[model samples]
Target: MTRLLIGALTAACLVPAGAAAAPAAADLEITIRNVLPGQGELRIALFDTANGFPDEPASTQPTLRQRADGETVRVRFPGLPQGRWAVMVLQDLNGNGRIDSNLLGMPREPYGASNNRLPALSPPRFEEALVTLGPQGAQIQIDLKQP
Candidate 1:
Protein backbone atom coordinates (compact mmCIF):
# COMPACT_ATOMS: atom_id res chain seq x y z
CA MET A 1 0.00 0.00 0.00
CA THR A 2 2.76 2.45 0.80
CA ARG A 3 4.58 1.61 -2.43
CA LEU A 4 1.33 2.10 -4.36
CA LEU A 5 0.78 5.51 -2.80
CA ILE A 6 4.33 6.62 -3.64
CA GLY A 7 3.95 5.43 -7.22
CA ALA A 8 0.63 7.25 -7.57
CA LEU A 9 2.13 10.43 -6.17
CA THR A 10 5.05 10.20 -8.57
CA ALA A 11 2.74 9.71 -11.50
CA ALA A 12 0.61 12.68 -10.46
CA CYS A 13 3.70 14.83 -10.16
CA LEU A 14 4.75 13.89 -13.69
CA VAL A 15 1.53 15.38 -15.08
CA PRO A 16 1.61 18.99 -16.18
CA ALA A 17 0.13 21.29 -13.55
CA GLY A 18 -2.05 23.15 -16.06
CA ALA A 19 -3.18 19.92 -17.69
CA ALA A 20 -4.32 18.60 -14.33
CA ALA A 21 -6.08 21.84 -13.48
CA ALA A 22 -9.24 23.13 -15.16
CA PRO A 23 -8.63 24.85 -18.46
CA ALA A 24 -8.95 28.61 -18.39
CA ALA A 25 -11.85 30.27 -20.14
CA ALA A 26 -11.10 31.37 -23.66
CA ASP A 27 -12.00 34.44 -25.68
CA LEU A 28 -13.94 33.09 -28.63
CA GLU A 29 -14.05 34.98 -31.88
CA ILE A 30 -16.83 33.86 -34.18
CA THR A 31 -17.14 34.81 -37.83
CA ILE A 32 -20.56 34.54 -39.46
CA ARG A 33 -20.72 34.94 -43.21
CA ASN A 34 -22.72 34.69 -46.45
CA VAL A 35 -25.90 36.69 -46.17
CA LEU A 36 -28.50 36.60 -48.93
CA PRO A 37 -31.14 39.18 -49.69
CA GLY A 38 -34.20 39.42 -47.44
CA GLN A 39 -32.24 37.67 -44.70
CA GLY A 40 -32.41 39.98 -41.75
CA GLU A 41 -31.93 39.63 -37.99
CA LEU A 42 -29.34 36.93 -37.33
CA ARG A 43 -28.48 34.99 -34.21
CA ILE A 44 -25.66 32.60 -33.35
CA ALA A 45 -25.09 30.03 -30.63
CA LEU A 46 -21.97 28.12 -29.61
CA PHE A 47 -22.32 24.55 -28.36
CA ASP A 48 -19.91 21.95 -27.08
CA THR A 49 -19.77 18.17 -26.98
CA ALA A 50 -17.27 16.07 -25.01
CA ASN A 51 -15.78 14.77 -28.22
CA GLY A 52 -15.91 16.32 -31.68
CA PHE A 53 -18.55 14.18 -33.36
CA PRO A 54 -21.83 13.71 -35.19
CA ASP A 55 -24.08 13.96 -32.11
CA GLU A 56 -23.04 15.90 -29.02
CA PRO A 57 -24.51 17.90 -26.18
CA ALA A 58 -24.33 21.69 -26.00
CA SER A 59 -21.67 22.65 -23.48
CA THR A 60 -22.52 26.33 -23.60
CA GLN A 61 -24.85 28.78 -25.29
CA PRO A 62 -23.32 32.03 -26.47
CA THR A 63 -25.93 34.08 -28.27
CA LEU A 64 -24.71 36.05 -31.28
CA ARG A 65 -27.15 38.66 -32.53
CA GLN A 66 -26.77 41.19 -35.31
CA ARG A 67 -28.33 42.72 -38.42
CA ALA A 68 -27.82 41.48 -41.96
CA ASP A 69 -24.55 42.71 -43.39
CA GLY A 70 -24.84 40.64 -46.60
CA GLU A 71 -21.23 39.67 -46.05
CA THR A 72 -18.96 37.84 -43.66
CA VAL A 73 -19.01 39.12 -40.10
CA ARG A 74 -16.54 39.03 -37.23
CA VAL A 75 -18.02 38.66 -33.77
CA ARG A 76 -15.97 38.34 -30.65
CA PHE A 77 -17.09 36.16 -27.75
CA PRO A 78 -14.93 36.66 -24.72
CA GLY A 79 -14.29 34.19 -21.86
CA LEU A 80 -15.61 30.72 -22.70
CA PRO A 81 -14.83 27.35 -21.23
CA GLN A 82 -12.25 25.31 -23.09
CA GLY A 83 -13.51 22.20 -24.81
CA ARG A 84 -14.80 20.78 -28.07
CA TRP A 85 -17.42 23.12 -29.47
CA ALA A 86 -19.75 23.75 -32.42
CA VAL A 87 -21.76 26.71 -33.70
CA MET A 88 -25.37 27.43 -34.74
CA VAL A 89 -26.37 30.54 -36.68
CA LEU A 90 -29.65 31.59 -38.27
CA GLN A 91 -30.76 34.43 -40.47
CA ASP A 92 -34.19 35.39 -39.21
CA LEU A 93 -35.11 37.73 -42.05
CA ASN A 94 -38.70 38.25 -41.13
CA GLY A 95 -39.78 38.23 -37.53
CA ASN A 96 -42.47 35.86 -38.69
CA GLY A 97 -40.71 32.54 -39.59
CA ARG A 98 -37.43 30.72 -40.11
CA ILE A 99 -34.79 31.47 -42.71
CA ASP A 100 -36.32 31.28 -46.16
CA SER A 101 -34.75 29.12 -48.87
CA ASN A 102 -35.23 28.90 -52.63
CA LEU A 103 -36.94 26.21 -54.72
CA LEU A 104 -33.60 24.46 -55.27
CA GLY A 105 -33.51 24.06 -51.48
CA MET A 106 -30.58 26.39 -51.42
CA PRO A 107 -30.86 28.99 -48.73
CA ARG A 108 -32.83 31.81 -50.30
CA GLU A 109 -31.72 33.60 -47.16
CA PRO A 110 -28.76 33.31 -44.77
CA TYR A 111 -28.05 30.67 -42.13
CA GLY A 112 -24.80 29.04 -41.07
CA ALA A 113 -23.02 26.55 -38.83
CA SER A 114 -19.56 26.63 -37.34
CA ASN A 115 -16.22 24.91 -38.00
CA ASN A 116 -16.56 26.49 -41.38
CA ARG A 117 -19.26 23.94 -42.10
CA LEU A 118 -19.54 23.81 -45.88
CA PRO A 119 -22.33 21.55 -47.03
CA ALA A 120 -21.36 19.22 -49.78
CA LEU A 121 -23.86 17.09 -51.74
CA SER A 122 -25.21 16.47 -48.25
CA PRO A 123 -25.62 18.69 -45.21
CA PRO A 124 -22.70 19.37 -42.90
CA ARG A 125 -22.33 16.77 -40.17
CA PHE A 126 -21.54 17.52 -36.54
CA GLU A 127 -18.15 15.84 -36.76
CA GLU A 128 -17.13 18.14 -39.56
CA ALA A 129 -18.08 21.18 -37.48
CA LEU A 130 -16.53 20.47 -34.11
CA VAL A 131 -14.10 23.07 -32.79
CA THR A 132 -11.61 22.92 -29.97
CA LEU A 133 -11.47 25.75 -27.44
CA GLY A 134 -8.39 25.36 -25.30
CA PRO A 135 -7.17 27.30 -22.26
CA GLN A 136 -7.55 30.55 -24.15
CA GLY A 137 -10.72 30.94 -26.19
CA ALA A 138 -9.81 30.46 -29.86
CA GLN A 139 -10.35 32.46 -33.01
CA ILE A 140 -12.30 30.37 -35.49
CA GLN A 141 -13.59 31.07 -38.99
CA ILE A 142 -16.91 29.71 -40.23
CA ASP A 143 -18.28 29.98 -43.75
CA LEU A 144 -21.95 29.10 -44.19
CA LYS A 145 -23.15 27.73 -47.52
CA GLN A 146 -26.72 26.69 -48.23
CA PRO A 147 -27.62 23.62 -50.21
Candidate 2:
Protein backbone atom coordinates (compact mmCIF):
# COMPACT_ATOMS: atom_id res chain seq x y z
CA MET A 1 0.00 0.00 0.00
CA THR A 2 1.17 3.50 -0.84
CA ARG A 3 0.87 6.34 1.66
CA LEU A 4 0.29 9.91 0.52
CA LEU A 5 0.50 12.97 2.72
CA ILE A 6 -2.46 15.26 2.10
CA GLY A 7 -1.45 17.78 4.72
CA ALA A 8 -1.05 16.88 8.36
CA LEU A 9 -3.10 13.76 7.64
CA THR A 10 -1.99 10.95 5.36
CA ALA A 11 -4.21 9.11 2.90
CA ALA A 12 -3.58 5.46 2.23
CA CYS A 13 -4.08 4.16 -1.26
CA LEU A 14 -6.23 1.23 -0.32
CA VAL A 15 -6.41 -1.67 -2.71
CA PRO A 16 -9.73 -3.38 -3.25
CA ALA A 17 -10.43 -4.27 0.37
CA GLY A 18 -11.43 -7.77 -0.69
CA ALA A 19 -12.93 -8.60 -4.05
CA ALA A 20 -13.98 -4.97 -4.60
CA ALA A 21 -11.64 -2.78 -6.64
CA ALA A 22 -12.78 0.35 -4.81
CA PRO A 23 -15.26 1.39 -2.17
CA ALA A 24 -18.13 3.80 -2.52
CA ALA A 25 -18.63 6.52 0.07
CA ALA A 26 -19.86 5.45 3.51
CA ASP A 27 -20.36 6.50 7.11
CA LEU A 28 -17.93 6.39 10.05
CA GLU A 29 -19.09 5.37 13.50
CA ILE A 30 -16.78 6.67 16.23
CA THR A 31 -16.91 5.22 19.71
CA ILE A 32 -15.63 7.40 22.56
CA ARG A 33 -14.68 5.78 25.81
CA ASN A 34 -13.77 6.73 29.35
CA VAL A 35 -15.92 9.81 29.49
CA LEU A 36 -16.07 11.51 32.84
CA PRO A 37 -19.18 10.66 34.82
CA GLY A 38 -22.00 13.22 34.73
CA GLN A 39 -20.22 14.83 31.81
CA GLY A 40 -22.65 17.49 30.60
CA GLU A 41 -21.77 17.65 26.93
CA LEU A 42 -19.22 16.58 24.31
CA ARG A 43 -18.38 18.35 21.10
CA ILE A 44 -16.76 16.54 18.17
CA ALA A 45 -15.60 18.10 14.95
CA LEU A 46 -14.45 16.57 11.68
CA PHE A 47 -12.05 18.16 9.26
CA ASP A 48 -9.95 17.32 6.23
CA THR A 49 -6.57 18.97 6.64
CA ALA A 50 -5.88 17.87 3.11
CA ASN A 51 -8.16 20.69 2.04
CA GLY A 52 -6.45 23.15 4.31
CA PHE A 53 -8.51 22.44 7.42
CA PRO A 54 -11.82 22.56 5.63
CA ASP A 55 -14.51 21.50 8.08
CA GLU A 56 -16.74 18.49 7.69
CA PRO A 57 -19.81 18.30 9.91
CA ALA A 58 -20.33 15.51 12.35
CA SER A 59 -23.85 14.11 12.56
CA THR A 60 -24.10 16.59 15.40
CA GLN A 61 -21.78 18.80 17.47
CA PRO A 62 -21.47 20.35 20.83
CA THR A 63 -23.88 17.51 20.08
CA LEU A 64 -24.07 14.21 21.99
CA ARG A 65 -24.68 15.72 25.37
CA GLN A 66 -24.73 13.25 28.26
CA ARG A 67 -27.17 13.78 31.05
CA ALA A 68 -26.31 11.21 33.73
CA ASP A 69 -23.07 9.24 34.21
CA GLY A 70 -21.23 7.01 31.82
CA GLU A 71 -17.81 5.81 30.76
CA THR A 72 -18.44 5.51 27.03
CA VAL A 73 -20.33 7.41 24.32
CA ARG A 74 -20.86 6.86 20.66
CA VAL A 75 -21.22 9.38 17.82
CA ARG A 76 -21.63 8.91 14.13
CA PHE A 77 -20.59 10.81 11.01
CA PRO A 78 -22.44 9.86 7.91
CA GLY A 79 -21.54 10.21 4.22
CA LEU A 80 -17.92 10.91 4.92
CA PRO A 81 -16.05 11.38 1.68
CA GLN A 82 -13.70 8.50 1.03
CA GLY A 83 -10.48 10.26 2.01
CA ARG A 84 -8.20 11.43 4.76
CA TRP A 85 -9.73 13.29 7.70
CA ALA A 86 -8.88 14.56 11.18
CA VAL A 87 -11.07 14.86 14.27
CA MET A 88 -11.16 17.09 17.35
CA VAL A 89 -13.20 16.38 20.48
CA LEU A 90 -14.00 18.79 23.25
CA GLN A 91 -15.45 17.83 26.59
CA ASP A 92 -17.66 20.62 27.90
CA LEU A 93 -17.51 19.98 31.60
CA ASN A 94 -19.77 22.96 32.15
CA GLY A 95 -21.21 23.34 28.69
CA ASN A 96 -18.69 26.09 28.06
CA GLY A 97 -16.94 27.07 24.87
CA ARG A 98 -13.32 27.03 26.07
CA ILE A 99 -11.49 24.02 27.42
CA ASP A 100 -9.98 24.13 30.88
CA SER A 101 -6.52 22.85 31.65
CA ASN A 102 -4.20 22.61 34.62
CA LEU A 103 -0.88 24.33 35.25
CA LEU A 104 0.96 21.13 34.43
CA GLY A 105 -0.30 21.50 30.86
CA MET A 106 -2.82 18.77 31.34
CA PRO A 107 -6.45 19.22 30.44
CA ARG A 108 -8.69 19.73 33.44
CA GLU A 109 -11.73 19.20 31.28
CA PRO A 110 -12.65 16.39 28.93
CA TYR A 111 -10.90 16.53 25.55
CA GLY A 112 -9.59 14.07 23.03
CA ALA A 113 -8.55 13.49 19.45
CA SER A 114 -8.44 10.76 16.92
CA ASN A 115 -6.57 7.73 18.23
CA ASN A 116 -6.78 9.38 21.64
CA ARG A 117 -3.61 11.25 20.69
CA LEU A 118 -2.27 13.31 23.58
CA PRO A 119 -0.08 16.38 23.79
CA ALA A 120 3.25 15.01 25.03
CA LEU A 121 3.45 11.53 26.42
CA SER A 122 1.72 9.71 23.56
CA PRO A 123 1.20 12.23 20.79
CA PRO A 124 0.03 10.27 17.80
CA ARG A 125 1.94 10.40 14.55
CA PHE A 126 -0.02 11.04 11.39
CA GLU A 127 0.58 7.53 10.11
CA GLU A 128 -0.41 6.03 13.42
CA ALA A 129 -3.96 7.44 13.32
CA LEU A 130 -4.70 7.93 9.65
CA VAL A 131 -7.40 5.46 8.62
CA THR A 132 -9.04 4.24 5.46
CA LEU A 133 -12.83 4.67 5.09
CA GLY A 134 -14.79 2.32 2.91
CA PRO A 135 -18.36 1.64 1.82
CA GLN A 136 -18.83 -0.83 4.61
CA GLY A 137 -18.09 1.93 7.12
CA ALA A 138 -15.54 1.74 9.93
CA GLN A 139 -15.24 2.36 13.63
CA ILE A 140 -12.44 4.28 15.38
CA GLN A 141 -12.07 4.47 19.12
CA ILE A 142 -10.73 7.35 21.21
CA ASP A 143 -10.02 7.18 24.89
CA LEU A 144 -11.44 10.21 26.78
CA LYS A 145 -8.44 11.46 28.68
CA GLN A 146 -4.85 10.86 29.78
CA PRO A 147 -5.34 7.95 32.06
Clashes of each: 5, 0
Best by TM-score: 1
| Residue pairs with backbone atoms closer than 3 Å in model 1 (clashes) | 26-137, 27-137, 40-93, 48-59, 101-108
Show pairs that collide, candidate 2.
none
User: Candidate 1: where is the Cα deviation over 4 Å?
Assistant: 1-20, 36-39, 50-60, 101-107
Question: Quick one: best lDDT, which candidate?
Answer: 1
Cα lDDT tens digits, model 1, 76-97, are: 8788887877776767767544
RMSD of each: 6.8, 12.8
TM-score of each: 0.64, 0.62
